[model samples]
Target: MARIAFIMLCHKDAPGVIAQARRLTASGDFVSIHFDGNSDPADFAEIWSALSDNPSVTFANRRYRCGWGEWSLVAATLEAVRAAVAAFPNASHFYMLSGDCLPVKTAEYAHDFLDSNDCDYIEHNDFFASDWIKTGLKEERLIYRYWFNERTQPKLYYASLAIQQKLMLTREVPSDLQVMIGSQWWCLRRQTIEKVLAFCDSRRDVMRFFATTWIPDETFFQTIVPHVVPRNELRNRTLTYLIFTDYGMPVTFYNDQYDLLLRQDYIFARKISAEALELRERLGALWADEGSIFRPRTRGRGFSAS
Candidate 1:
């Protein structure tokens, strides 16, 4: 069986995070958690107390005050990955997840699925090649520097963005590197993660440029992995299921969606609330019977690029 390391980025909802962690715990699978520095540690006291005795669980020592659209999120994730790698040397695959994320399948099913495939499961798309211009803020995100907090200084943010656009001070990504954007969640092989970390260490210029870019977490891994791994080695699909609202925020799952969620092939689902008692109970019951739901399914050796 393949040993898996789950790197979870959590901000709030202690009970929910603990429940998700418990569901994913197995003999050979390790969980590495990074709680946002901005969140009060008191909120997570129960979680730490519960998992402190579990040898399989490890917490990131270098935590970050992560902000939306900031590089801090990516930094925290890297810290979790580093801590996990150090703690679980035998881990074959590393999965990035959020506190709200819950396993839709059993731990045994997840291990078997990963063990059966060699390709990295990640979702990505070429930003310039796609109709990203339709999103309106694509140029602003790619060209101008958004170092300041948009929420605190909305006028200054827009003024700076406008000046950069009017002055045509648009910056180009490194000529050799292709810009890839995607969902933040992914599962990568141990070798792939090591290669990506090495690339980051050697390429300080690329890292510095992306530091001021909007939502760097969504692009950092997506951009670096393609350069390190061959196209045939990538699955180009995230195994987690998320429903987006018109405003682009992920919709929280409820008890009513239990049957619908179970019908999907995704191994996990996200953005569930800790207080959702009915949904939590239903999901718990489903997890107990996932062995029957996820019977061994055969496939070809490699994955095709999307």
Candidate 2:
């Protein structure tokens, strides 16, 4: 049996978080959570209580005060990963998820799929890719320093952003390191995860450079993991579904979208709200009925060290 460690980063929606965790819990799967430090303890009391009795569930003692497009998000995720790795040393794989994320496939299917495939499932694109940089979004994110203060007033925040854009205080990222950006959510093999954590521990310079970069969570892992692991061992696809809106926020799934989610090839879907109880129940029923067999679209050789 393949053991899986789920490293989840959560801020709010206690019920949804618990529901997602409960769905993935199995004899060989462990759930490790890191609640945002900014969130009140009282707000997460329900979550703590729900998982406290479960031996397979663990919580990070030190949480990061996460903010959008800030390094804190990366910090919180790394904390969860480290905690999970420590608690479940025998786990074969580690899946990074958010509180709003729910498994589309059953736990048995996940394990079987991982058992059959050895590549790391992560989505990434080179930072200098024309599509990502055409609008200067990549340049602004990787070059210019962004000072993000979550508590800043809207007007002041815009004003500071405008000034930063005008000044364009660009910094040079290390020439040896290739910058990559992608979805933060991913499923990595245990060996890959261990190598990534080791690389981060030794590379303080790389860490400091990304500390002030916008959305470091999207770049940090993608940038470093490729360097540490063989390119062939990396499958440039994340097994999670995310739909972005014109407003830039992900569209939350509701009961009406249940059919759409089931049709997706992804193993998981995100932004499922607690209020979508009917959808949750329907998915749970499907999970109960599904067989343990997992059929991958394609199979490759097991991962090899670089």
Candidate 3:
């Protein structure tokens, strides 16, 4: 009963969403989700009912208008994390994710690997300190939600540029006021999460200040994690990166790329087709059918990600 929380933000991608839930449950791991409020309740309800019997499923009640770089995403995700943290305070770590993500390995393997390592797989550092987004134009950024109504969502992203090009029109930034940016997904230790929440509370002003910034989610999580982890704990590079062109984080494997993915050192790749004859698909499906996920790449590890 190693506790692992899955934070999924979903809207219209029903097939992918259901497939992912099925796979995770099959793996016998715990998962929690944050569905977009902008989505269809009926559709969500159907999916929820299908998954309701799974002891691992915990759904979030709050929703926000998530945009590319607004604080809404950070705020919403933090809220979800807070809920999961409180409910399963003793869980070892929280693994971040979106609903469309397809795992490259067995879920059980991934969970067991993390369970064994006991390391936080987040990449936070001063590495991107000088990036354009963090250079003192703090008032225009925000976070990106997993899904959105383009009209409302686009404007959230626009605020950043509007503030930059039309508002201040200055390119210069001061050293102390610099902002940071990086990947939004991570696997964080329980203690690390507390620190991030504390930082959010202390920097309510900072979080509030970036509510309208260009893309706060990328920077919000990126910046804060680096600050909280023990100096030696963070990897400086993310354990999680986009899988592929899957706007939902696609990891492209042509019918031919299967063998290569299995041989790679990475744990989660975007996804292989839910139905295919390729090794990964066959293996993933086989493993998935047996109730496994993110497991190691041994020939015996049952299934692959969707």
Worst 10 residues of 2 by lDDT: 297-306
lDDT of 3 by residue, 25-47 (tens): 56655566677776787877877
Q: What is the TM-score of each candidate against the true structure?
A: 0.90, 0.87, 0.72
lDDT value, candidate 1, whole model: 0.80
Top TM-score: which candidate number?
Answer: 1
- Give the lDDT of residue 8 in candidate 1: 96
- Cα lDDT tens digits for candidate 2, 1-306: 778888889888787778767766743578999999888788589998988788788888788888887888888888888888888778888888887777677766777778898899987789876353334256767776666563555576567677877887578997888888778889999999999999889989888888978778888998888989889999987887776654455677898877677666677788786789888777765554456444434322122232
Give the Cα-based TM-score of candidate 3 against the true structure. 0.72
Q: Write the per-residue lDDT of candidate 1 for residues 104-206, one digit (tens) a residue.
A: 7767677778888898988778877865233557746777788766766779778888888799888878788888888889999999999998998999989
Error of 1 at 272 (Å): 1.6
Best candidate according to lDDT: 1
Q: What is the lDDT of residue 230 in candidate 2?
A: 88
The C-alpha RMSD in Å for every predicted model, in order, reads: 4.7, 5.9, 6.7
Candidate 1 displacement at residue 188 in angstroms:
0.6
| lDDT of every predicted structure (CA atoms) | 0.80, 0.78, 0.59
C-alpha lDDT (0 to 100) for residue 31 of candidate 3: 62
lDDT of 2 at 212: 79
Off by over 4 Å in 2: 133-136, 150-168, 288-306
